[model samples]
Target chain A: MPEGTFCNRTPIQSEKALKRLLEDTGGKTYYQEMKALEVDRDLLWGTIQKTLKSRLRTWLGICAHCGMCADSCFLYRISKRDPRQVPAYKIQSTLGEIVRRKGNVDNAFMHMAMETAWAKCTCCNRCGLYCPHGIDMGVMFGYLRGLLYQQGFVPWELKIGAGMHRVYRAQMDVTDKDFVETFEWMVEEYEEDYPGLTVPVDKQEADILYTVNAREVKHYPEDLAEAAILFHLAGEDWTVPSSGWEQTSLAMFAGDWEACKLQVQSVYGAMERLKPKRMVGTECGHAHRATVVEGPYWAGRPDGRPPVRSIHYVEWLAEALRTGKLRIDPEKRIRVPVTIQDSCNYIRNHGLKEITREIISHIVAPGYFREMSPNREHNYCCGGGGGFNGIGLYRPQRNQALITKRDQLLATGAEMVIAPCHNCWDAIRDLVEEFHVPIKWSFLKPLLIKMVQVPEHLRPENS
Target chain B: MYEFLAGPMFILSLCVFFVGLLVRAIWYVRGLHWQMDRVAYGMYPGPGIKGAARSIGYWLLPFGTYGWRAQPFMTVAFFLLHLGAVLIPLFLLGHTLVLKAATGIALPAMPARIADFLSWAAVIGIAMLALRRIALPEVRILTSAYDYFILLVTAAPFITGLVARYHAGDYAFWLSLHMFFGEVLLILAPFTKLSHIILFFMSRAQIGMDYGIKRGGINGKGMAW
Candidate 1:
C-alpha cells in the first residue's frame, strides 16, 4: 500500500529471471526468428490507417488518467505495481505509440509493439469493466493484433496452428480417418459402461452437431469419452462430423481475418452439408465465442448464420436438463467444496454467467458449491485466454501474473476448482501445480459425467 | 485592456471554441465507418440504445460506477473537479453579468455563497488531481506536459477570479488576468484533451451501446454500471 512496499504480497519475477525462463521455454529463439522476418513499412502503415476507426481513435484521445483501471489488472497487481504492467500504460506504449508515429514505425518499434500486444496484455477486457468510460481493451488489443498479424509478426504457435487449421481443418492436424477412429474408440470405451452407447459420425440431419478442441484428440481423449457418455445417456441425436470437427481457431487469437474466415467456414461449411439443427461447441471459451459470436463479423455476414445455432457446451447441458433429457442425482454429487473460475470469453464477454451458475447449482451439492468472490463477469482471467497458454515468450511473467487468480481461488477454500474452458483449465491446473495449491482442477463436462445419472433403460443390461 | 478583454477577445475565443468543436465533431463522425462484418452475435440497436441511456447516468454519477467503488478517492476527486469546473463557470454571478453585457442575454446566477463554495471546491479538486498525477509513479509515467499545461490553463481562471474577488492584487489587473486565462482555455478546448468535455459523452455512449447489444442486457456481472 505504501511507496516502495508495493506488491510485497506476491513474488514478482525479475526481468533477468523472465528472460532466462523465456530462453528456457524457447521464447527467445522465437524472438530471434521474428527478428529475421522482412519488415514492410508501407503495409504496416496501410493496415494501421485502415483499422484506426473512430471508436479506437476516441478511446486513444479521451483517457482521463485517473488510473482506476490499475487495480483491475491482474498483471499490474501481481507484478508489484509495475508501471509498465498497467493496462493503460501497456496500451499507451503500443497503440499510443502507433498513433503517435502515424503508423510509420520501423522494424525495431514493430518488434517492441508485437511483444507488448502479444505477450504483455491478455486482452481479457476486465479493465473495461472497471474503466469508468467502459473502454473495451479486448477489442482494442484485437485490432492491434490484427495490425500486427498483417506484418507477419504472429507468435510461432498461432502461426503454425492457423496453418494447420487451413490445411488439415484441425489444430493438431487430426485427419478425417483419425477423427472418426477417435470417436469410435470413445464409443467403444464408453460402451463398456453404457453398453448401447454410440458415437455417431457424419450423421446427417442430426439434432445436435458436436465440435471439440483438437487438444481433446491429441492429449485429453477422455473428455470426448465423457461427451459420448452424456449424449448416450440423454438419448439425444448427436453426431460429430468426420471433417470440420475441430472448432478451435488460432486465427481468431492471432487476428488473421482470412484464416479466421477459412477456419470458421470449414466448420460451418461442413455443418451446412450435414444440416444439424444446432451445433454444440465443446468447453473451449475462445472457440465457443469466436464460432458463435464473432463468426458473423469475421465472415462479412451481418445476419449471423442461423440454421445451425452455435451454443456453448454448458448451454447444451442446461437445455438438456430443462427438457428432462439429461438427469442428475443430487445425492451423487461430489462431497468436497468446489468453486468456479468464470472464463472471461464465456461469462464477461458473452453473458453466460447466470446460466453457468444455474448449471453449477444443480450439479454441485448445496453446501459444497462455494462461489468465488467476483465470481460471475467480474472474475479474474486465468492468464491464458488470449493465446498466452501457447506463446512460450511470456511464460514466466504469465505465471507471476496468475498469482491474483490463484489468490482468488485460494480464498474460496474449495477442494476442487471448475474451469469450463480448455485454456482456463490448463492455466488453472498449471498455477495449482506451480503454487502447490491444494486443489484439484477439472473441465465441467468430466465432472458432470461423474454425477449425471444414466436411466435404467439406457444403461447396460448386465451392469 | 478591459474593453478588449470583455469584448472582441472574448467573442473571438468563443468563436474558436465553437468552430473548433464543430470541426472535431465532423472529423470524428466522418472517420467512423461501421464494419457490418464483425459486430458480435446478438448485437441489436434496442439494447444498445437502452444501455446507452442507463450508461449516461452510470457514468455521470461519480459513485455509480464500479471504478468509483474500487477507487473512491480518485472518483471523488474527479467528480469534484468536473463539478466545480463546469458548474462554477456556468452559474457564477460574475460570469452571468459578463455574458449579459456581451450578448444582451440574461440568465439566473447561483447565490454568492454557493458560488464561492463551488469555486473553492473545484480549486481544491484540481489541486488534488494535479498532485496525484505528479506524485503517483504509475500515473506520472502517462502524464504528458500537455496534461499539466491543460490543468494549469483551466485552473488559472478559477485561481485569479478568487484572488480578484478578495482584492489580493490590483482589482482590474487581476480581473483582466482571469479573463485572459479564461479566453485561452476556451480557444484551446477543442484541440487539446480538454475536448473530453464532448468526447466523454460520445465515447461512453458508444461503449455502452456496443456492450449492451453484444451482451443483450445493461445489467449483468462484470459491467461497470
Candidate 2:
C-alpha cells in the first residue's frame, strides 16, 4: 500500500508518450486478431452505433455533476476522498473520446480507450443505480470496451486476465484440485471445532450450490471455514459446486465481454450437473452482477443451458436471519468496532444494500459499519474490485483512487474492514497495510461463523 | 411571394409546435422509449397508480396551468417565443390578420407588453436562461456546442425581431426572421437533444404512470422514499 508501490515514476500523458503502452501491450491487440476470429465488423459497428445513439444524449445531458459518483465509489471513500480519482469522470472522458471519434477512431484510440473504459470500469453498474439520471456508464463502458476488444484494442493486463478467465473461468486460474484442496482445508479446520460438520464438495442433488471467489481458495481460506461452520449449524443442504464453483468473473472486469458470457455459462453448466435449485455468489460483486444482470443476456449457456436462479449470500443469509433459521447475538461481536465495507459490485450489481446491513445486524454491531461516504450502490470501488488489483500498471492510480477510502477506514477507528467480495478484501487489505492501518479484513461468512453461539444440541460434550 | 411562404411557415410552426408537443405528450403518457430512470430512484420504481398519477401531472402541466407556474421565467419566455413565432409571421406578414379580421378574434398585443417594462423583462428572462446555461459550470459541463448552438438558434428570431420592429423593417421583415428561426428549430428539434424539451414532460409522466401501477417502485432519491 505504499503509494510508491503503484508509482510509475514517469506518467505517460499523451498519445505520443503512451509508446510504452503499445510496446508494453504484452503483444496482442485484439483488433489485429479480430478479423482472424471472424467476429463481424458490421455487427460490431452496429452495436456501437446503437449504444451511442441511446446513451450519448444522457451522457451529455447529466445535470448533476455533484461528484456524487466519487462519493459512491469504494475506491474513493477507502482512499479518503483523494479528489484526484473519479471512475464516472474517468468513464466520462473515455466515453467522450469515443463520442468524439463518432465511432471511427484508430486502434490506438481503442488502446487508451480500452484502458480507461474496460479496465477502469468493473461493469458492476453501481454508479448507474445511484445516478440522478440513472445513466448506465457501466453498460456504456462495457460496450465501448467490447467494441475496442473487437477492434484490436486489448491491453496487457486485460489480455492476460482474459486468458486466465479462459483457463479457470475466473481471474486466477486455480484448478478443480485447488478448489477441492481449499475445501478440504476448510473441512479439516471446521472438524476441529465441529467434528460432525460436513463441508462436502460435489455433493450432487444438494438443495443449494455454494460458490466463492477464487481469491478465497488462493488467499482467504479462513472465510471458507466460516462457511462450513455456519452451514453446519444451520443444517442447510448445500454443496460446493464440484466444477466451475469459483464465483469471481475477472473476465467481466477485464473487459473481456465474450469471455464473461463463457465463464458464467460454465458455472451454469456445473449448476445443471448438480441441478441445485439456487446458486449463490460468494461475496464477489462482478460475478453476481454478471450472473443476475448480464449473464442472462448472453446467447449461449454451455450446452445452451438456460440461466440459473441466482442471488448473493446477503440475500440468502439475510432471508434466513429474518425467518429465524440463522441467529446471532450482536452483543457477542468479539472483533468490533467492525465496519462493513460495502462492495460496489454488490450494491451496483444487485441493489442488495438493505439486506447486506440487515444480515450484519444479526451477528455484528450494526453500528460497526462506518458509513463510507456513498456506501451501498453509491459506494466506491475498492480500486482493486474487479481485476484492477491484478493489473500491475494501474496500481498507483488505483492507490490514488482509494485516497478517501483509506481515510474512511481510519475515521471509523475499527479493527476490520469486513468486505464480502474477495477482490474487495484483497484490494482493501493492500490499502490497509500501505496507508498504514492494521485493520484485519474479512468477509461476513467467516466473521459470522466465528461469532455463532453454538446451539445446546450442537455443543460437544468433550469440553 | 411573401403570401405563400408566410402563410405556411406561420401556420406550420404553430401547427407543428402545438401538434409535435401533443404527440410528445402522448408518447410520454404511454411511456414510450423510457427505460425507467424513475424506477431505480425510488421516486416511483413501479409503473403503478402512483407512477401513472405522476405522469399525468407531468404531461398535463406543460399543456395546462402548472407549466406557467413551475418555470415561470422559462415558461413565460418560451411562451413569448412561441407566441412571437405564430403572431408576427401570420398576422403581420401572412395577411392572416387582414384575412381573419372579418371573421373576428384579434391577435394579442405582444410588440407592446404591459407598460413596456415587461417587454424588457421578457427579453431579460431569455437572456438569463441563456446566461445560466453558459455561466454555471455544471450546466455548462453538460451542454455541447450543438446544444449551445440550438439556444442561439432559438434566440436569434426574438433578437432580430426586437431590432427589426424597433428600427429598420416593416412587420414583414420581423415576420420573416421569426418564421425562418421557427422553421429551422422545428425541423431540427426531432433529431437533436433539443427535442428533450418537448419530450421531458411526457417522459416524466409515463415514468410516473409506470410507477403509479407497480407494487414497489424506485423514486428520485435513489431509495424507496
**Highest DockQ scorer:** 1
**lDDT per residue, candidate 1, A133-207, as tens digits?**
767676788888877776767776665565666667676657778888887897787686888888888899999
Residue A98 accuracy (lDDT) in model 1: 81
Clashing pairs in 1: A297-B37, A297-B38
What tens digits encode model 1's per-residue C-alpha lDDT throughout B1-225? Answer: 988989889889888988998787777656654453244324466676776777677878878876677777777778877887888777789888887888777888999998888888888888988988978877887788878888898899999999998899899999999999999999999988888777767667666666665542533542446
In model 2, what lDDT does residue A409 have?
A: 75
Give the TM-scores of the predictions, in the order they appear.
0.91, 0.72
TM-score of 2: 0.72
- Among the numbered candidates, top TM-score falls to 1
Q: Per-prediction DockQ, in order?
A: 0.40, 0.11
lDDT of 1 at A102: 72
In candidate 2 chain A, where is summed lDDT lowest over 10 consecutive residues?
A1-10
